[model samples]
Target: MIKALFKKEFIDTIRDKRSVVAALFGALFTPLLFAVMMTFNIEKARSVDDVYIEINNADMAPQIVELLDRESIFHAELPSTGKKFELNGETHTHSKISLTFSDDFESQLSSGLPANILINADYSDQERSSQIRRVKRVLENYEGAVLNMRLVARGISPLVIDVVDLEEQDTSTPGSKSAIILGMLGVFILFSVFVSSTNVAIDCSAGERERNSLELLLMQPVSTFDVVASKTINTGLFGLFAGTLSIALTAVVIPFIPLHKIGMAFNFDLEVAVKMWFIILPLAFFAAAFQLVTTFHAKSFKEAQTYIQYSIMLPLIVPMALEFSKYKHAALDYLPIVAQQQAISKLIRGELTDFTPVIGGMIVTMLFSYGLVLFTSKSLKSEKVVLGL
Candidate 1:
């Protein structure tokens, strides 16, 4: 009897041209978008050339120019000959630089007077900041080396000028390397969940209602619970398939990424990939169950679809809001998507696999799925939800 019900639901879904097309397009569209975005980001970062700086100084300017050249931080270009500076040009004023020396630069230094150098840069260009900082550091080095030479000439030990030196150590894990990508992964999961499950859920509930076929199925020998359960299983199966495809496509594409060039990159683990498959299966079940409950009470396929679309968006909005609000994930060892994301992130970076979260997420997902199915079955007994009220 259960097999018959499953077969009927599958056949109904297949016959619905709209549902089939939605799933196919959603599945193909998502991977292509991910690939294109990743490729563009990698190439853009890898291709930026070193910046160029122009200096106009009389005294000690040669020393500063030598400092800039030694670091290879920026190339020194001659003054522009054109009447006007064109920042829009592909090569020339793409950026502007100015370095000026004091009128009494060498005299001030000889008399123990404070000396100053002026640096002007196009602050509007965001990429120019790092090069600016690098140039500033080289200038500081030149100052320090000169100070040491002066002190030694006066028979003074340079040790008196130094007190404490500090160093910084970055302890962030490689998994946590790209907070943005993890955030992106969270978004991608939410997208796949909604796109994969929306059509199936709407078709099973509202679609059935619209066709007048739901009434005939209800009149049969099967219990209402069985009917609801069968539909939930069918929708979930499709979601699980879509989820698996998304993950598989991610794995295939990640290795091709230029990890070293970009500051952040995704590393794949076979074990994590396997674990994601397991984690997503239960998540798919819960997603389908949740969608069925939201859609079951609607009058027409279109009405049910509208309600389910909102339901699907909840997963996307909530996780993202949590991430943006900087809400540290609770002990996700017992949470669903939180745990799966946490564990998968760790696994990707070749860290210790916390099975506790994986098992906990699975159990929570399944329990919720069962509860949703029960609610859906009970709602079927109400004439309002079943009879188009």
Candidate 2:
């Protein structure tokens, strides 16, 4: 019966240490690595709230210095051990940025005239750009305060300078915002499906044929369809288990990403996680089926592995490429990897209003898997393939 074939293949796969390691590595290590990179990006992308700037003429503008301190910008002393940087083919140590107030800065302010604060630095250096911007914003605020005092003393409303009223309303939620940067989580989860089943798929197809076991199996009165179905079922389970674990691990990891610091929220609650698991269900089998087909076309385990390693990259690359291009279409919504990505993103953003497309896409994916299953079954009946010629 098909049950005996399935049991035999499943046990063989489980007993292979390589398959177990592939499953654990794909499911366990990937989500953790992704989280670590995301955390690094969060720190890099956010503006520095507290920064250090050097002041050349501290006595000339005490008010400016006070305002800078209030804004968490402090004067920095040059360090004894120099940290160096490279720009425009030049090697340099130290930020070397300083603010020099005009000699008559205090007098100009008292007489209601323009005061100059010259910023001195190598503007070409990219690493110091954020520090420069933060210091400039605080100084600009101090200028606005002085202008307001001037207007009050002259018996004029400070509102006269602001002739146009600019109002801004942000309607973006944290989940929607998180969907922008963290969308790759879905891609990684789907990629795991392709990765986890690779060793098992190769073992069931090319490895068996290479070991002269395929000819023996065909010698039985078993249907080739039964053999193909059992192999697919066995490999698909490994992919599915890995995919499911990927989703759960991603859900656990995303909450600790400091999304709130960047004004983004990702509510990967039980409902959304469950929905994501369901969305990837058909994809698991499709990935396994795809891997098996790729492997079965090759004559040996090494050739199959070479083909499989490249084949697995399609699931990872296609989704991310489409996403980075910011392209969307009504037709692409039913495509396999793209469909899962969109559905998962929508679920994370709490914008998945209709289940019809999700269900339709799932049906389409299963049909594709079945088509591969049929092709693989027919391949087994060939003399050249069975003999690994």
Candidate 3:
């Protein structure tokens, strides 16, 4: 009897056009969006290898110009023009690095006196900052040579000018860089599972109730538990399949994305994939169970759909917020989508899995699924839900 009900539920779900389209697009769209966006960003980063700089201080500093040329930093002579930045139709000029030399520049250096030169550029432009750093390094080297030449001319030691040397220590690991994206990808994957399961679960539970079919099925010799179990199992199965396909697409596209530019590496291990899928499995049941509970109370198929659609927003927004804020969400081990988000994100970052959370989440999800099944089954025995009252 249970077998017959399960088979029937599976068939009916597969035949629904709306469910099929929703599942198909739900599985396919995320990968397409992520792939295209990453590709565009990568191409844009690769486009501007050669940058243009206009220099105004040609007469004041032969050493500065010579230093810039020797380093292959190309610049064109613009009209004693100060550096102007135009972004979004707004222009700002910084003449800080723009050299306007004093008339007795050579005399000052010869007399061991400091000569002023102008420097100008926006410190805010990141790409321009990189260029400025290179230019600054060259200027520092030129200053060192001039300082040494002056010291020798004065019969003083150049070593007296030496001071402190700065050193940087970078302690960040590969995992930290991958952590942000790991969370985002996990959210996408878990949301895929939730979305793919929603249609089938809602249609099977609420659509059947609205069509007056659930009452007939309940009146039959089969136990209400079997009816509920079959619904949960079938929806979970379909959701798993759709989710697996979407995950596979992500796995394929990650390696192709140039995440390195943003300091992320898209490396996936088979062991990690298996663990992530395991973590995802219970969420599938949770989604199906939640959908069933919501749908059983909905008065119509459209009403059930509206509820399910809104339900999807919770998974989308919360996990994304956590990712952006870099909040460590350990307490979510028992929360449905939150649990899945945390676990799968850890898996992506190659973190050690705590069986406690994974098992605890599975137990919480299963209990919730079974409790929902019990409620729905009891509700199916009522005229209220079955008759859409």
List candidate 3 stretches off by more than 4 Å.
37-59, 62-113, 119-162, 210-212, 219-223, 259-266, 317-331
Best-fitting candidate, measured by TM-score?
Answer: 2
Cα lDDT of model 2 by residue, 12-122, tens digit: 999999988998888887799889988998998885455555687889999889888887776765545665544358544555678889899999989989988998877
Clashes of each: 0, 1, 6
- Arranged by lDDT with the best first, the candidates are 2, 3, 1
Q: Over the stretch 1-389, how does candidate 3's per-residue lDDT look in tens digits?
A: 77888899889988898888888777777776777877786678655343335565456677677777777654543334556655458554432334455677767866778876655667886756777777778778988898898789889998887776668987766567756645667777777887887889888888887777878877778887788889999988877877888888888887887777666675676677778788888878777877887888888888988888876786787666776988675665677776777777777777755778877877887888788889888887778887788
Sort by TM-score, top down from the best? 2, 1, 3
| Worst lDDT 10-window in candidate 1 | 82-91
Q: State which candidate, 2 or 3, has the greater lDDT.
A: 2
Clash-forming residue pairs, model 1: none
Candidate 1 per-residue lDDT, tens place, 1-389, comes to 77889998889887878777776665556666777776787687677455567665644657777777777644455445732343446444323566777777878877877788888887777877777787789889989988999899999999989887667898765456654555566456546755887898988898787778888888888898899888988888777777777777777776766555666656566766677678677888888898899888778887887787787676566566667888674564556566655555555555645677778778987888889899998988888887888
What TM-score goes with each of the models? 0.78, 0.88, 0.76
Of 1 and 3, which scores higher on lDDT?
3
Query: Which of the numbered candidates is closest to the native, going by highest lDDT?
Result: 2
lDDT of 3 at 345: 77
